[model samples]
Target chain A: MIVRPRLEDHLVIGKYTGKVIVGVGLLMVIPLLVSLGFGEWDTAVDFVISISACLIFGFGTQLFCRTEKDMNWSHGLVVASGAWVWATALGALPHYLSGHASSYLDTLFDVMSGYTTTGLYLLQDIDHIANGLNMWRHLLTYAGGQGIVVIALTFLFKGTSGAYKVYVGEGKDEKLLPNVVHTARAIWLVSLTWLVVGTAALTATGIWLGQMPIRAFFHAMWVFMGAWSTGGFAPQSYNTFWFHSLTYETICIVIMIAGSFNFALHWAMWTGNLKEIRRNVETISMFVTLSVTTLAATFWLAKANVYPDAMSLLRKVFYQIVSGHTTTGFSTVYAKAFVTQWGPIGLVVTTIAMAIGASACSTGGGIKGIRMGIMSKAFLQDIRRMVSPESALVSQKYHHIRDVWLDDGLVRGAMTITVAYVTIYAVATIVGVLYGFPLDQAAFEAVSAASNTGLSCGVTAPTIPALMKVTYIASMWLGRLEFMSVFALGGYLWSVVRGR
Target chain B: MMTRTRTLTVLVVSGAMLAALAAPAFALATYPPNKPDSTELINHQNVLGDVTKGLFWNGKAITFHGEAIGEVMVRGDYAWIHLNDDAYMVENIEEGAKLGGYNSGMAVWVPSALTKQIDTYGDYQHEGSIVSIAGVFNGACKQHGGDMDIHATSLRVLAAGHVVVDPVRPWKVVLAVVLASIAGLLFWFERKYRYLLRQSGRVGT
Candidate 1:
């Protein structure tokens, strides 16, 4: 039996969601101040309008729908989902106003891409953009990578359990402290510490590469934000090619690998538990997958003789495979080169890596490592059952923060989300084929989009069909949220349309 | 008398016609630059092969006005420089505010001697040198991993670029002032709430 949610339930959600939105508005002040400092008055005005709109809409919603009712799990999920939708819509104002994006839809696509940490962009004239707008671009990825809701938990929301609910609903399960807010702070603390170190190192390298100190610092900070978030946005149209330094590439590679590590792993490392780095289930899984994918891509490229030498092959082909695997989407090769240079085998290896993705509770999206671990366990268990005695009993255990014994419920959850991800990837591929894109390119791009990996095989441009654009957008949203909140939103909408 | 007058008129007319034909030739002799003796003239689109393959211009010396984009990537004796001759351009930094659409560019490897004249590189803040290059374009170069590139035989900066000055809009000041005031109001309200809470002993001061 289904109990239709009353209108009052929505009011409760609106109140909390409005709180998150207000937090987002306040967060805009950093960029606003940056633009003002840089005297990028055009970008400043756009931020002013956007910031004002967020505050007004947020306060108004809270004023009208203010509720004393305690937030349930459903209410928390609704608020989290609502916050993302609102964030994407209102967050798009800066991109749209900047005149870089073609339209409101394009801005929305880019905003969602940033917030989801999917590095795909519909932004044009990136090289000529103001410092302030560029700051906002990288900032969105950084903030979104940790999560806006998590920020709200630290300062805005007062309730403890309700805050935890919202956190869980945002597709995060790891908690470093008994208090969720403390955990949020710990995550930020780790990230900020890395940020300072990474930025300083990168800035030095940038200066060495002949950039002015100020420009070097700016590039360092933005690139750090992109890398730390695994967001993959570069300040120039050529992306990483602008710097053209091997040192810069190496630093970014380190950052990308580190960024894809789970916050739990970071917490363990912060303590005396150094073994956590090796023994973690996600680490082992990453090792296996990375080796397979990297080797497969290298051997294929070597056979094809696509690149001239070992250096070129590693720089162009290996880096891309690593980028796809980490879901970092930092491409040294041109977008079209996926089709032209890498060829079929290279694309397949990249597609597999993209689908496998990075560690769970990290700044990456796809079928996470923990789930893959569980799935592998389940496969082994089934095979053991088939071969052994009828009464044979085998138990599986995986080390995360602790030993997590595999259960039916865990398997079900893992399998369900994995199936959902695969289904969406397949659907997007079919739609791409229907639109006349070649088969392998479609599959590669589909997996890229659905997995929130920003690597493109040249299909995700402004010129693509409108339906395809929306399809990719939906795939990113669903994949990022891991399908639960979106399903809830869909169910709620359906109930409203049909129910008494 | 009529025969002599007719002969004088014909001589005068022929002299004027000869002078008129020789005028452009004299101007060409005094002109500052030697015309680059190249048959093919190309743009960024021709080098990048956007709508169609740029195979015809491949391995051919051509001349075009190209704006050096990004940094002059200094690699040993030679430099890898990117240049654009696209329709998308700003006459000045202020004019760049109204720019719409994407930036298109092509990479050219030129001797450092030629690139020394490039004082400014095109980016958000500064415009690069718009130089005309007589170079050979490789559609698929064995060097640089099949990248489409140009090897320049000669390069000349036709126009110089300056730092773009982005002016502050008046409305921005107004909004900033307004938002600051609102922020101030909120701060006061928060202080008042804390004062009341202190009076009520709900929290430690």
Candidate 2:
């Protein structure tokens, strides 16, 4: 029997969603201070207006939807998904007010992309945008990478038990500690520690590469944010290519690989479980997939004579493959070069890498390495069972934070999510093809969006069919939330319309 | 003899006119000139579009023009400067220019001495110097770890850049003030609502 949500259910969802909105408003203060620091009065006004709007909506919702009821599972799922929609809508104010995006929809797309850590953008004249706006863009990725729900859990939510449900709804199921709030803080500690070290290294490299000290510092901070989040939002249009330095690319590579690691793995390493790095299934899976993709891409490029020599081949092929595998969209080449230079084989190899993506419970998005590891072991166990006696027992074991034997439910769950990812990727690709893009290019872009890898092959632009833009937006949202939460949100809305 | 002379002279003149008429068509059929016409110069999108359609401009000398954006980063005898040819090059967003599209630009590697002619670079505060350069475009420069760049042989500043004064709009200021006041009132109400909930030991749906 279908049961409609009660008034308290609505209140609980609204109250929690308001708290998230408040957090979004608080986040604007960083950029607001930045604009004031640079004496960008016009830009400062944009933030002020945006901040004010956020506060009004957030506070008004809280005041009106006051309730003592704690969030249940459905409320948590709805809040997690619903908060993203609100955040994206409100968060776009700064981008729109800057007069950069072509329209309000474009701004929403950019904000959603930023929050999902998908780096595709449609902001016009990014080079001419204010420093504060640039700060906000990169900051969006950094905060988004930590998961907005995680941020809310860390500070706003006083109730502990229900908080974990919301945290799980954000697609981060692994807890580094027993308490969800502690887990959120631990994620922050890992990110902040990397921020300092990574920013300093990149700053030095930028200065050595002849950028002015101030410019180097700001670029370093922005790039560090982009790389650490695997969000790939470089301050300039040229992306990492603007620097044109090997050292900068190397630093980005290191940060990107590290950032793609699971938070639990980081905790293990931080707490003296050094051997965990070697025996971890996710790491092993990542290494194998990266090696295969890199080899395939390198071979393809070598045959095409894309680069003149070995070093160029290594730099171009290896870097791009790693960027794709980590699901970071930072590119050293122009967008069209993939179509012009890399050819179809190179494109397919990269698409595969992006589809496999990085570790589970990390900033990255895709099928996830942990799932791949389990599925591979499952396949191996199945093959062994086929050859053995019919009554004999066959089990597959994988090491994550600890050794675990894969069960039928675990494999089924992994397969379901993987199927969901593949389905979305195909749907998005078909939409792109309907818009008259080449099949290979469409597939590449669709997978890129669906996997939250922001690499583009000249298809993503302001002038693309608005329908295609919406499709990519939906893909990014679904892929980031891993489908389940969004499904729950859909069911809740349907029930509201037709429940008995 | 006089008639023959007249006929030959007329024929010679006719032949000369016909030759002149055919020359332009012949020239059009021949290979295009190395120097690009100012009106027909390729923009970023054109170059990118061509590449996306499977055309390579590697090792090809081309002409590109745009506003010199950001700062010139010097490395040895050559410096790297990004040139933006987007709509905001002449007027900016703050100056009430309609949004065109995303910034489309190319990276140029010019001699350090040539960059001196560029006085200003575009940012939030100023419009950058507009410069045109003739260069060899690399699809992937082997020297710079396969980066897409242009190695320029010549540069000319077409327009001098000046500071753009972007005074805050009065309407925005007024709107901001109004919104901030409303937000403050709402915050107070929110706190009061929470307080009432606590005091009553139950909350309204």
Grade the docking of candidate 1.
incorrect
Q: Give interface RMSD for all predictions.
A: 5.7, 3.7
Clashing pairs in 2: none
Off by over 4 Å in 1: B1-65, B73-80, B85-101, B134-153, B163-205
| Candidate 2 CA-lDDT value | 0.87
Please give, for residues A66-138, the per-residue lDDT of candidate 2 as tens digits: 7777788888889999999999999999999888888898999899899988899999888888999999999
- Measured against the true two-chain complex, the DockQ scores of the candidates, in the order shown, are 0.16, 0.31
Calculate model 2's interface RMSD in Å: 3.7
Cα RMSD for predicted model 1: 8.7
Model 2 regions lying over 4 Å from their true place: B1-56, B197-205
Top candidate by lDDT: 2
Check candidate 1 and list the clashing pairs.
Answer: none
TM-score of decoy 1: 0.85
TM-score of candidate 2 relative to the true fold? 0.91
